[model samples]
Target: MQNFLKKLRFDDVPILDKASLYELLNQRFADEEKKLSQIPNPSLLHDAPKAAKKIADAIREGKKITLVGDYDVDGISSTAIMIDFFRQIPYPLEAIIPNRFSDGYGVSPNLLKRVNADLIITVDNGITAIEAAQVCKERGIELIITDHHTPLDTLPEAYAIVNPKLSTCSYPFQEICGAQVAWLLLGLLKKELNLNIDMREFLDILCIAIIADIMPLVDINRTLVKEGLKVLMSSQRPSSLIIKDFLNKSSITSEDIAFQIAPRINSAGRLEDASISLEFLTAASTNQAYKQFEKLNSLNERRREWEAETTNEAIKLVNSDDTIIVVAKEDWHEGVVGIVAARLVEHFSKPAIVLSINNGIAKGSARSIGNVNIYELIKQNGHLLTKFGGHKMAAGLGLDEQDIDAFRIAINESASKLNSDDFKSLDEVIGILPSSEIDIELLNLLESFEPYGEANSRPLFLIKDAQILETKTFGKESSHSKVTLRQFAHEKKSIELIQFKRVLDIPSEKKLTCSYRVVKNEFNSRVSAQLIINKTYNY
Candidate 1:
């Protein structure tokens, strides 16, 4: 890996130095390993206890309840939690997931006309539905909103609103996602009723939502994921029969969620209907769950095909000289634009926006790399946008056909003035590892860094003078690559390491420097040392 590290250079990254990288990973993993009895619960900001109580009373009385959920994993997982919790109370409950392209976002008048229930519960959304809640109020429908997104200036008039982002809320950590909020709601219910339901029973579902929402894996989130993965591995949770079937055959990890489960759940929204995933999660019987699970698996296969096509097109758009890329194509599926935006951001190593253009409007998704804030960028140009809102790293926008060119030009101008050095390249020196430290003990110490996602990335160690011993591509389409690397780090001690999915463009021969993590690969009743490559260089 000596040759590979030679090519690494970052001209201007003021905050992140080699020392900082080491400290970040060491401190992060060390802190995560110390498990807490429970995460410090954020107090309810708004005085909505009465509303939650009322819903609990309704649930206790066996009244009909319906939940409105978003069409993504966060929404689905939240729905699953509430649905499973309500089942214990033996309450009549149902859920609805709006079509992403048609219903837009949040509770709408169109949706109110569809479901006939005594009370309505919204998950992962509905923090800013003034008019829709008004309609529900007029129709005598009580609403309980469990969301974590920022609220509007005037809160909606609902039966009860539970959101961590509320200004008046006293929640210690205001950064939780909607599924976590739903999990909290369940916790509240258990406390009030003094139910003996196993607290860890639902962690597996929460883990899926936690990873899917891209929330920071710190604070209370870390505990949830830490314990959640344990419960999932034990196969003790109320999960879909198909999920259990898969887990029984193979060991599950964070990698399983990213590569296996989350994609299948997300595939529903990208390709067909997201309701398929919700049905699978909340299915009444193993037979029903199997059918739904199979359907989601098939849908995920289609999603892969669609994403491959769209990514190719997005890569072509990157050849342009603009600081920000805005690409629109009529054939692209709107639901998958966010995924395409993410893919483009990785490929170009810059902020990117992907739009599905049809008729006279463009609906798009934007993703940022490094320190670029797409939300702030869009807010500066909000006047030109028909609708736009999101967090720092990701955003969504709606643009009128007439103003697309102007918006693009304005964003490009803003991007040009920003310092490009911060993101000129992704050549980061993660860690420098002594060759002697590449052993089972080191790999075991790394286990403290569980439930890695977003900001809580896996630790990457830099090692020098590694030679590629073998290279092969696996998987049906040859989309995955596996390699064996050999390096002599100490006095006459040779280390053989395995790396997975290193890009083909990466040269195979010569001394290379690699940013990697040491992990244990257990196979054939033996545990062997392996290196998971994050980035490599011919330094």
Candidate 2:
């Protein structure tokens, strides 16, 4: 299944046997009004109006309008949104995505060396660019910052800073990704310029950013993703087409976005300069899109290699006694450390931070489990950290190499206050889908709630007490399998299940209970509902 995952979208874990899962789904369905009729006012975000007006004035004054962005998926998507919007206006624009290795994240002082513009706007980043903002002030550049990351005690000195996370912000939703901030800024910009541009024109890209950034899929985020995914499926953009063609499926789901699309877009940023992704998203033609698409695939492969290697080494250094896992090593690719942190959290079911050391400076990424605010944990030791900023679930930080041991001890000591129950992984299952009930109609019913992600994930159903009647193994190293199972409780109806990353040590008993997700299996031009095994249990 590991190799199959590499070849296709295979993502999952844990199970809960609960009847209230149905009630929860019912309540969610009854409250379809979660979809807002109108998006929240952009002016509600602190400084949005000021930033939009400043940008409009820049365009009218014929000032060199430059947009700066970060290198992550949210950052790349934000830059792509501005690129697409300006292109639609037929306006000449200069866009910059800081190189992770060279320019560092956001509009930093180092990145300022390459930035030359009269009016510069930052998207998805710049909330913490205190030094860079001071530089812009000293250099006579009009800087407008639009970011969603939580602001620190001292804010940047940009001319207009638009971020909903600002303490004074009255925006209805507080937990939006960076690209949302960027897109809303464009919405206000449209109003300021009195342009006929429809802001909905970019949700196809916006959806990708929201999912990739792991924003909670509820309220405005859900509304935007649902609408954006529809546009993405039907979008004529070369990038969208490239994705559909690559997946080879007519119906695109949020899982496809999370597992298949987002990774490829993020791979370039993780392993190389994010500008490669910026180019891919804004590809002008099919030829251009495919040309960049190939590069993304190559980079994605390399990212996987680096991530696996680092994860293996980091796992060996894990201290099982600690509440939080902090692993640091010399020469691990800084670009892949974040992913390594996530892998560690997944493996140990604990919060983790992985740092790569170079020249006596350690920089790395942090990933948290449920209810553990990793950003806050890292912030608790701010005096030890040279730099750090992010939200609850994830963050990045830098510190002197000598402080690694103390930082680790301090963070873990702080983590001791957290409830142990919060560390337990919950795999919510919509229990008992009889083999006979698994069909195209059932799959369609499940997919009606599109764009499943954080806070609103795709429902998993249990097929209990199934007898594994037959099995066939194939794929790389026989790591994939096709099995026929019968549920005696359902009059012995049989279903074909495809399991990826085959379990190494199943109980000797032939009877097994499995929790699985319904996926369309296309073989020999025939499409049918099939189960993708998430976890198998013998009880």
Candidate 3:
């Protein structure tokens, strides 16, 4: 018999029955009521009200307002939210998304030298743009910085700065994404100017940023995503509709945004300029949006090809005995290294860093598994790094090519001293349910906890002693399997289970235990519950 580990249990959370599980989940996972009202006053965020007033003054003075944004999903969404808001007020606003290759991550000196504006407002970035802030000051352009990244020791001397992570800020939730921070500032701006604007219209963009940036979906984020998903489903937004149609999704979910939409949007910034994605998000016409979507789709295909090629090369550099994996190669695409690092972590279950070498300089992205603080590890070796910044689980850095080997050794040594428990495989099973209990009703009930991501995840269930009646292989590469499963004791009731990217061999006589999730499969105007098998053990 295959050993089945009961990894997670809600014994501490009081639950009388299946009907009460929702309440239990809410009690345990949700920190506060997920309502718009639950969001704290925007003024509580450091300089948010000041930023709003600055923006209002700039509008009144008829100053040219330029928006500088980063080139990621969060940054693009933040820009889109601001553009959508400004459209209501009839302002001549110019938006710029810095090219990853040309202007680097944020508002750089290169960008400031070209921009001609009386006022510059940076969204999703600027918290780390110390030199750029100086450049803006020198150019006599009033600056407003709104971002969500962790601030450094000394903040930039901008006209007004809005970031919840600031030590002086009193916002209850500090984990919000960049778009949410921008949305909050816009909300304050709307109230200050008494502008008749429906702020809820921008929630869809906020939802995309929150999920795409991998923010923990709890507290206000949960509420925003919950309501945002509804708006997205009913939204006539040209880009949203085009993307939905492109993916052939009948209903939008958090997973759909994370897996389908975010990747395509990110591909533009990754392989090319992010303006394509920003244009797609803010496209006013269906034709324009569709054209942008097709372009992004093509870019995503190219990204996939590069990602696969780089991942293979990265894996070859990994040693079986290494606790931390660091690989560098000249001519590797800088944009795809982050994805390559993620794939390395997933495949090896270790913290990994992938660097692209150019002109004796190495630029790298790092990803961590378990509780490893990859950022801290990189920071500890700051002497060897030219630049580095990121959160605990992920980071980006630059270093001299000669320092790559030394940095790798130092990071691996640091990782080795950490707890071995961090490296252990942990199953994230929520609970077990009998095959008979799996139905559309249960799926609906479970979906009440919608907008799942990061901290708030979709539930995985274990089904034991299921008999496999039939199996078939599908997909273009014949790498997918469709198996009909039923309880051993209850043979009449069968469930169709789908497994992606993995071909399984199930003997006709052998019973299996499976870990799966219940998902609604829609086809030809009909919806039915289906099991998505994550893993299976035969006994």
Candidate 4:
């Protein structure tokens, strides 16, 4: 997302010196060890022990156990975690992620038609499977649901429902993603069966899911991601090996996983069957992993193309005066609607819902900007929606094609109740800094806050009075630019910053204030300090 940043000044917090900066940071990051250890026991989740016992009975009885997973990275990772754990027991289990084109999201009646099993488990989804759970009950298939999404007032009547957001849930941390819930339940199952499985072994993939699902990077999530990055750094997983080879980097960071890896895994589900990603992640051979990665990469490229086209069309539908943006096209690729909604949110600074109409139902995704809760906004207009589910910042829903106009107008009317500030951009910059401070040390200070996402984000610094020494568009189609600039702080230090997307129109005077992020760039065994230009304000 291109950022037009608002300055965040800590006037009383001193950071010009190391001691004070460390003090402030220490205060921000209180009790690292205590917080890291706060990942409570798995049994704390409601229905965990019962779910584990039932699963253990199924495993012992040699019953057919099928895991119904969603299509996103979280769902795939949750399924992959199950695959990894079950393979250790030498217990064969069936795993399937819903097909975006055919089955749509989560456990649906359409998807259950393809499942034939004695035991069925849902990961990352099924919280809203009121009808599907009923179908399973009628079929006498034991259902176990493990999810992290916010549940409805009426829960699924399954054998077990484990969700952190459940009103009766006992889990301490509610922000964990679906894979974490899946991993936790499996952890309890391992205990029930007295298996010697090392749960940390799954962190490498678990971290990917946590980041991909947009879980807040704090407390339990922080520790897991930190450890997961460590395992990923030295792990022998074929997917990890292939990613390292593809990126030409010996180490991977959360940013790398979020930007480079998550999208690839998500691309499979977005445009095709997520099973491709599942197979790729659980591939037995590096060569096999390479093939799957190729497919994912290609699909990701195609997703980008479609997303650009869809976003362009969606942009035409936006009305600047609308408190909330609602846009839909008859055949907009449903896979890219969420991204288009997110783009509209970022660009227009309004909550957006982008839908793809086909048959007679319009289904798609919603993204919010600032403080507007997209889920609540949509829920307020639930009379027009056939179905809707999500949290504060994101959601997915569907309604009748005829209700699209009503939804648009109704949702905007609902949004009008929100404070005016709710529609503004959430981007933030931590005050100003001299470009001369763009050294390895300052980069390290930022790096101290590893695994930035959700609650914790990489800090942006405003560099004022920078002289653009040279600028030229790079990359295919001139999609990016490499700008060399010297700050007024020191002419001796000129830095290269990359700006993505449409090339910026450099000021005729070649002077501007750049909102940038300092990064440690390593390439071909060389390490250097660089910056990423997000936005530039002209004088």
Residue 164's lDDT within candidate 1 is 78
lDDT of 4 by residue, 1-539 (tens): 12222322323212244444445445656655434346799899999899999999999999999999989999999999999899999798999888988888888889999999999999999999999999999999999999987788789899999999998988898989999999999999998899999888898899999998888778889899989988887789998788777767756778889889999999989997898999999998999999999999999999999999999999998887788888888999989999899888877767889999999889999988777788888888888999989778889999999999988999988888889877765565555555455577776776787778777777666666678899889888999988888866436877778888869788888876667776678987887777788777654
**Model 2 — which ten-residue stretch has the worst lDDT?**
6-15
lDDT of 3 at 467: 73
State candidate 2's TM-score.
Answer: 0.92
Q: What is the lDDT of candidate 2?
A: 0.83
Off by over 4 Å in 1: 1-24, 29-36, 60-63, 152-155, 237-241, 247-251, 414-427, 434-436, 463-470, 474-479, 484-503, 506-513
lDDT of 1 by residue, 134-251 (tens): 9999998888887876565677898888887777777777777788887777777777666777767788888888887777788777778777877777743335446857645345
Of the two candidates 2 and 4, the one with more favorable TM-score, higher being better, is 4
Q: Would you list the clashing residue pairs of candidate 4?
A: none
lDDT agreement with native, every candidate: 0.73, 0.83, 0.83, 0.85
Q: Can you tell me which runs of candidate 3 are displaced by over 4 Å?
A: 1-24, 30-32, 247-250, 421-427, 463-469, 486-492, 505-514, 536-539
Ranked by lDDT, the better of candidates 3 and 4 is: 4
What's the lDDT for candidate 1? Answer: 0.73
- Return the top candidate by TM-score: 4
Deviation of model 4 at 463, angstroms = 2.2
Residue-pair clash count for candidate 3:
0
Better of 1 and 2 by lDDT: 2
TM-score of 4: 0.94
